[model samples]
Target: MALSPQDLHRIAQSRGWRDGRVEVFDTASGKVTVKGLRATRHAARYHLLNGVARLLGLPFLQAAPMPGGRQAQQTEVARLRALHGVGARVPEVLHVDEDHFVMRWLGQDHLGDVIQSHHPQAAALWREAGDALVRLHAAGQYLSQGFARNMIVDGAPAAPAWPG
Candidate 1:
């Protein structure tokens, strides 16, 4: 099933956020940050969401800390680091909290906003992003939240391959 906008909204609000807000932050040291308070209900929803994510064989709540609270977040990071062994690419998990995670943010503008222009660089990036998805699926995994923002576009597209 597709992620409901309502699900997004509830999770968003549980973090005390609203539309168009900078729930994300950039510290002076070039580190990126996001802040939210942990909500039990929100965490429950994440648990359900995680079930779907695992079925896809992709990381879920990689950003969410476990129940031991702050300590658990550290464990989550250690667990995700192992994904490179299986060929997964995610931003560096910087710091974790009961409610939020900081990562090495490779920033970008909204793809829709930028897509209107036929920039050669952007087109190449899109194709590469698609290929990344294809690679993940070939590993018997997929992103439960299959949206453009979740993807990180590297320099160029990898060669095409048959989709699973």
Candidate 2:
């Protein structure tokens, strides 16, 4: 479902940021999630630092915090659309403005949490996760935030596995 800029703003006002970054808003219409500029800008800084490192003949620098809101959201939307076009599982982008964009709510524990918990199905889960990444890369773009924390698994229980 698409939300207008006003809708996004209204929702943001309703639900404060999570971890001081993401905001999740569930409405009678549908659920919308908003992510701030941290990760996107971090990737930007990574590239900037990477260029400097290359000029100095040094190893690549790690991603650092980037600063910008709307631009970051634009970049993110483009990236998401690209990934979606290539068959990657991603949230549906609803609307975008300068500071943030509204996207269909994708609710689930982060893949990282599940992995850390040693889910009995961890092997299969990891395999599927790796395959998704491979597919995304095969689409000819590297997702800067390709960490397990960024991946969501739908319909999975919020529990850990017992050791066999």
Candidate 3:
């Protein structure tokens, strides 16, 4: 079933999710993370950054604003599919709507967290992450957010794997 905004709100509330752009809830199949996209939600911030970059004559620093609702959602879905197709460890998209999409929950820990906590497998994890990125780039796919915080650590010390 296509989930509307109201339905998402209800599900989030029922599951005691805090108010945020992303919510994670469990279903019979598995846990999924649903993200609501608002094209204009961060317009002011993007505009401000763009203005600053333009004033500094740094066109390359200009940030692209989110596209319209449907387009943004579509782009996200397409990117996820593309990345997955390239054998990149990314969330598997399960459902979508004009304003929201749901993906399988990879894990709870971020790569940054694991590295900061000095996990025993940190070095191996880093190596695996680097390998994954090389593979992704070799496939001509790139991640807009390649920061450690944006990378999720699926399995760590016990069963180290590439960050998703």
lDDT of 2 by residue, 68-122 (tens): 5666666679988876677677887876655566678888688887778887777
Per-residue lDDT over 9-35 for candidate 3, one digit per residue giving the tens place of the 0 to 100 score? 555454332247788876655677888
Model 2 has an lDDT value of 0.71
Compare candidates 1 and 3 on lDDT and give the better one: 3
Ranking by lDDT: 3, 2, 1
> Each model's RMSD to truth, in Å?
12.7, 4.1, 5.3
Enumerate residue pairs that collide in model 3: none
Name the lDDT value of residue 11 in candidate 1: 40
User: What's each prediction's TM-score?
Assistant: 0.47, 0.75, 0.74
Best of the two (1, 3) by TM-score: 3
lDDT at 132 for candidate 1?
79
Q: What is the lDDT, from 0 to 100, of the residue 73 in candidate 1?
A: 48
